[model samples]
Target: MTNYNAVFAATFAAGAGVMGMAQTADAQHAGHNNGMSDFDVYASSEYGFCDAKKIASVWGQSIWEGKMTLANKVRAGLTDLADADIASAEGVRCDWSEAELTYADATQLASYWGNSIEEAKSKVADLMSGMGHKRFVETFADAMADQTEGDEYDVGGNFETYVASSYGYCDAKKIASVWGQSILDGKLTIASKVSAGLTDLADADIASATSVSCDWSEAELSYDDAQRLADFWGNSVEEAKSKVATRMSEIGHKRFVEAFDYVLR
Candidate 1:
């Protein structure tokens, strides 16, 4: 046998290396008058390989001017220029300068916006337009932490809305965690439970029922039992119950929670 798989893999790897070298050569040739080094060309090739067209476009526009470090960072996937700034560079005038963000800021902004460093910076810039650089940095950090710096009611209101929409209390907790709130404490309250559509079940009893197995749909649920079932299914107790209710209702069963009432009987 000719071992076709091994041969194909080797051929693909060689082709990729050749492609990288060719792109580097092209970048060098294009920027010959600008004194681009072999390393710069290699970095540009890597940037292109990463599908960072915007950064590549900006590099080409600047003719490698003041961009060696930024290009290296982009090639390494450590940071990227802002997208809008790159677009501005690609325009006829081509006066867009380098991104003003640090590597950490760029990385965080990229994660927040789920976009290239360039785009994230532009969005962040717009968001922090009126603030000084220090204020912007501090505000960005606070925003990521979900803290409003003592802005009362904003976090709670948002959490309440998230819980009420049947998204589950855990998800609400995650949101609240970002805002530095203890959502568990908030959700444990009677008003919060009712608002989230959760039935009042004793937490201790729910803790005792984890090993018990029965047809959940037909069983009566104490608060404890419901909580255990919710945990088992990776949902909020209210969400688990709501799903059961919806399923039973679909099958023409009215009073859905009552379907589980037989456990008590």
Candidate 2:
């Protein structure tokens, strides 16, 4: 079997600018066990070569960094060991862990995909459906390290935060529009509609929604944000709006119809 302990020891030594020919034979044949019981078993199993390579790269880097606890390194090392495609795509010599060593620098990716980190992670996670939670955390650790510096498990926390942000069945605009139209359609006076729509909403959302609700306003959904929404929903603006409308309460839809008739008067 290939000696992964020696391989990682060399890689770790290289990162620290240390190299000794004698250390090679020593690590390979004579080094004491470092308690990698699972890794040893994994390296000896069928199809362990590629998986061993991936784990060693990450494990070595974690060791060289000398910041993470040993347990954390072992936990981190187990990630991304099964993604043959990701490894192949990266390079003959590179896995996701290796790629991340240089940093994927996901800020640019995030910017290209969406307005926020949460949106970026959502889009990425959708595309990488097979990626596990541990692998995802390890892969995006650099981007998150900067965003949530000073936390021990910032990357994991950021991952959870992004996933949570991606999930709401409704968005601010959908909620506001439904509520606004409902108030407008109510038996209550016109004054009540405006007041209700404007209530508890941020000035920015209200301003934008008002522009959307009032056909006369030149300020529509800005091209960039609209494009982002279209990309995220994978639908045209009209289609997305229609979908949002379907998700509204029946009373909310009825309110929109009543409000439309009132406006026609």
Candidate 3:
């Protein structure tokens, strides 16, 4: 549940399978994105009238909040909150399953676990030092998922960045100039070709600083997926990659941080 790559990639591949060769140029175009997987990842446009830059402002707001959350969590001494939260949340998310649990039920579960939502959330994990790990696991069943405090939220969308090169996909060029500068400055002088390539396009629209939102929305983590992630822990392929971004930051990896560092900066 914590691996960024495994968590999000599994969701993406599961939700939107490979596009395969299309029949027409236009249909091929919608396959791009704005939720469509086009040949480019820089997000040119999709469905004919899509605008990549229009949402720049929104992404910026998201980044601000994300950075603030990370900062606040650190201050609260909940350095591992995101990981635990994401894993527990993912473990019990409501998207892919039909278990009678409404969106309200999800939020309510958070409340039921404790007086304050944060305290209640902390109650979600066994690793959590508080009073409720075993209870949380038993009550939520095997469905709910939450990221470990060990991981941070990662932005795994923007498919163009990862689509294999042989296909000539578009990559986001926005320099992550705002987010994680120190990491980039430490070990790696430049980013990988795929990331570096997107720098120009991501910068073309200097709307707002963008940070990753819930990369793996509750919609993506069904009960079964959450169960699998929790069961695998660090063992399986999908469970581990699910939270790469957070782990990268935790392990303080120079290479992984380089991926999102330039997007906001």
Candidate 4:
């Protein structure tokens, strides 16, 4: 009634203008610091103003030296630096981003690699380019857990070759956990649990069964029993074995003696 359409258009135009100015300011600020743009610094996530400022400062000091691809990696929590590092970098009045591996993950990774974080990060960058962050972390963690003595064993090379020749990280980790690091490192030529007709299960299932020393291959349960065990107790084949064994033992001397005899045999 009161030229509402015109009013809406004006309001929209004014909002757009304000947004344009803000973006311009951000771009200018980014240019003054480095070749980074406002989009580069803040477009990755929904970070607040202070967080954006902190990320910008950190990127300028630490991550700017690396490839632009590394910005997403930093955002993904792969960098050793954290919020604290951002604060420290800001306080130092430094021109370069002094991003280093200062976080707990860095420490764990460094210890696993038996090298400093800087050295580990170089390898990690390579792994990240191909395997991605999650796969890289899982593969490295598997390798580390299996490693007994080594400063480093050309893990990047090993991972590349392994993935190319065989399956991906999850399968590789499962094999490595069962067969040992020697299999992955090429000390041992070939091993196959799967080839032997072993039941292929999730890593959690295998881990749980193995923890309780359950032989999944030989253990047999009805579908209902397995489902109940899985859903109620969160039991793997191995975990269910003890419970089943106890129940069988108790029931064998009672009405289910024939069934127990068959099971025992």
TM of each candidate vs. truth = 0.18, 0.21, 0.20, 0.19
lDDT minimum window of 10 residues, candidate 4: 93-102
Give all candidates' CA lDDT scores.
0.36, 0.31, 0.28, 0.33
Model 2 residue 113 CA deviation in Å? 13
The 10-residue segment with the lowest total lDDT in model 1: 91-100
Q: How would you encode candidate 2's per-residue C-alpha lDDT over 1-265 as one tens digit per residue?
A: 1222333333333332111111222233222245433223222222222233333344443111111122233445543333433243232242222112111234445765555644554444443333422355455555444433333243333222212221111222333353442211111122233235542333333333432232100111122323444566789965644443442222232233233333212
lDDT tens readout by residue for model 4, 7-108: 222332233212222223232333222443323433322222223234445565212122222344444564544434334433422110111111233446
Worst 10 residues of 3 by lDDT: 45-54
The local distance difference test score of model 3 is 0.28
Candidate that beats the other on lDDT, 3 or 4, i.e. the better one: 4
Q: 1-265 in candidate 1: lDDT tens per residue?
A: 1111122223322332222222333443433424544334334332211123234344542222223334445444554343233334333221011122333345566787789866775665554433322234445654344323352243344333332332222222232333333333323232244455553332222223233222223222233545655776689977876665444333211123334334312
The lDDT of model 4 is 0.33
For candidate 4, report its TM-score: 0.19
Kindly report which residue pairs in candidate 4 clash with one another: 61-96, 61-97, 62-97
lDDT tens readout by residue for model 3, 48-149: 000111121223322212323333343345645533443433222221111212222344556545456343333332222221222233446434444334
